[model samples]
Target: MTTSPSLLAAQDLHVAFPGRHGAASARAVDGVELDIGAGEIVALVGESGCGKTTLARALLGLVPPTRGRVVFRGEPLTYSSRALKAYRRRVQLILQDPTGSLNPRHTVYDAVAEGLRIHGYGGDERAAVAEALSRAGLRPPERFLLRYPHELSGGQRQRVVIAGALVLEPELLVADEPVASLDASVRGEILALLLRLRADLGLSALVVTHDLGLAWNIADRVAVMYLGRIVETGAVEQVLTAPRHPYTQALLSVLPEAPGDPVVLTGEPPDPSRIPSGCRFHARCQILAGGEAERVGVADACRSEDPEVLGGGGEAQVACHWARAGITA
Candidate 1:
């Protein structure tokens, strides 16, 4: 199969914020290189505090990168007011918490119409709102137009949040745990909705999620993040079923269907301000725990040299000393 042209690319992106009380700044996103192709859904998966959300914000132009740049449709994304306004219209952010994202005071119609008003949509605002609502699965849009956030169920509230983004007619969407706040039953519905939208609208999405299952359900590609960097990235089946990186292997080992005992990783991720010298995951790596790296003869490199994400976006790529050489246990 052929690869589509990338609609958004993050090249060596890094985002840092000042630490508590004059301490050194903490790097939330460090050296994240990722690409989201046109009409593709790329899931950014990892545990909490792994920089997935920060990367999403940087992509949306909501947070400026400390170092590196984000490219959109072959152009370097800019933060100028005019440029930002245009970018915001083309790239929408679907927040995790629908209840929190929506204005409690605004009615459903008002919430979805806000983007239209901001973007100067002069043509039939009412029809635009109705269409957006319908696209988001809130059918008979007029029936929900007068409802408020508290009046709707959790699932319906999230749909309104989606309708708000859909109203902008964005070509790309950055959804941060879009279904995390919904019920299990609603989760499948939301995921199905995303798949349908992708097929129907040719919309591209960068979804930040902690659920591996979600990636399996909807993402065309999966990029596994750890501590601020992608440890592995590839087609969803490739990365999830045959992960090359030790971290990826350990992560997949814990899946419910994974046979035998889980390979539990020890040690917490290093502080971003004090990330280790070489492999960021070496300290907690299962493969390197009991002299396995020595057996593989890659201990020296794993301890002293940082490995860049290898492979030029082929079917799969991993950033690890052993992974590149097929040395995982």
Candidate 2:
């Protein structure tokens, strides 16, 4: 049967934190919107401190948004006791740091079974734990069951964290930089594991990461965030191979390439606290000059006013005015 379009949706979501009283509040997520469908993997990517983690937290209901809503299975989410409980059951988050997230004191069994116990999966806890561990590729369930987080290797510990989330049988999984702490070789293994889980269990995932290479390898779609806003989003091929936003282009320009083609960025990304007026990217954008009346469709209002996400050629949605003006062409 054809599944529904989306299992989780974040609509015009805005999240902010306290800043200097007179100054603008620290906006971590600015009017962010996206959807994750059943069995689809969406990668949220950007430079560090671009609000990927904040968006992930908002989706999980760990923190309330300043504006907009998050809907799960077509139902609006709330922080009410009943709503929170139900939400927790259906949506789970796998943190980046396996060692930090897991309890050093608890055995692998206890760590993986904690979710089950919390949700009252009393009778089936053992079976669920075994199944979860096995699913995560932690074989010899009996052997792993008694091991502590300290006893397991980095990769194994990460698998245990995944198993812990899987035991709950959540429909949507939010993995925030799950492999960030691992070695380069171990990172590939973890990525493979996640891909396998998606194929086998038919789980929908939202992976938040700063690595464009990782996103390119596993994501069906990619969303590029900057200064807490999604500057571009579309199928992986569309956004990564041929990006429209200047910011997106700047990001891709810095990626490591083949021996002949060297990657370089002209300038550094702008600071979020002191975001430039109009286009947040104008400060560092190579397309726009210092004072040339912003260049018609390319600059114009784009440099003076924030542009909303607009559907560009193909299935991509870009927030740059120049994208339509053939700047990306």
Candidate 3:
């Protein structure tokens, strides 16, 4: 929670996709509101199919929101091609897989220089590529310039992908599972690189990941998403140490602890097309299932009325009927 105004924000954002047999479009994302301020790192944490990645895409305008708007620097995003391109140049996306993101045929120099070409850089492209590669930790940039994707190691390949994004000198990065495919040792390197980039360049980032540990490692704030909507948001220490929402508590319980039984959740997350009414997580919530919700007199509301994000804002916000009643397990 930086006191500075938000650099990027989602205002009641929603994203839906067409369903089978011309059925009603399934809402993959439903009314997600988030904010990332200058020089701040925000992690969007959740399970698979939780719409964290889609929300990242929507923020970058790679996928248009079905409703609401994305605001950058306090202005609504424009839909025009030119405006969108400019916006994209300011906000870059870092994909999950380094192997899939890099082109096997293109040399590292050409790959890093691609963005410069697309945006019609008038200066020396080679110098820009070299600087980008250097900044991305590929020291002695010339050593990597001639190498193809196949010639590089996995860590090197990811660096190249990051270098590609860095070449544009973007203000904000929407990184979706940026280190998921790397080796355990290499994961730390990438995370450190991201932190360094943020510190050195004043870059803000929205990282989408399932690893709560990663969120704790780098993010200033963490937003926990379940079935598209954010159920809890707070400073990393606050959310991870004292989670208010049932879903957040359950998620944290699974993290490898010293001596506690992990909260094993039953059943898979609900399908997007058949999303549950009211609180989407009610069906899988252990607290609600164990009669605690009834004791708190929120059982009815948990099953019928949608719980909105509440918690007096700033560094701690939760969207749960039971949580509003101070009933977090």
Score candidate 2 by lDDT. Answer: 0.83
lDDT tens digits, residues 1-329, model 2? 11347788888888988778677778888788888878888899998888899999999999899999998888989899888988988889999999999999999999999998888885768988999999999887888999999899999999999999999998888999989999998998889888998899888889999988999988888889988888898888878888888777767777777233333445666655566778887766666753332555456676688887532112578887677666543
- Where does candidate 2 stray beyond 4 Å? 1-4, 258-274, 290-297, 310-314
Each prediction's RMSD to truth: 1.4, 2.9, 1.5
Predicted candidate 1 versus true structure: per-residue lDDT over 1-329, tens digit per residue: 11998899998898998899888888898888888888999989998888899899999999999998999999999999999999999999998899999899999999999999999998999999999999999999999999999999998999998999998889999999999999998999999999999999999998999888889999998999998888888889988887888887877788898876898888788888888888989999877777778887899889898998533242678888876666645
TM-score against truth, every candidate: 0.96, 0.92, 0.97
Q: Give the alpha-carbon lDDT of every model.
A: 0.88, 0.83, 0.90
Q: Residue pairs in steric clash, candidate 3?
A: none
Error of 2 at 259 (Å): 8.7
Residue-by-residue lDDT tens digits, candidate 3, 119-175: 999999999999999999999999999999999989999999999999999999989
Q: For this target, which candidate reaches the highest lDDT against the unseen true structure?
A: 3
Ranking 1 against 2 by lDDT, winner: 1
Model 2 / residue 222 / CA error / Å:
0.3
The reply for model 3, stretches above 4 Å from the true place, is: 309-314
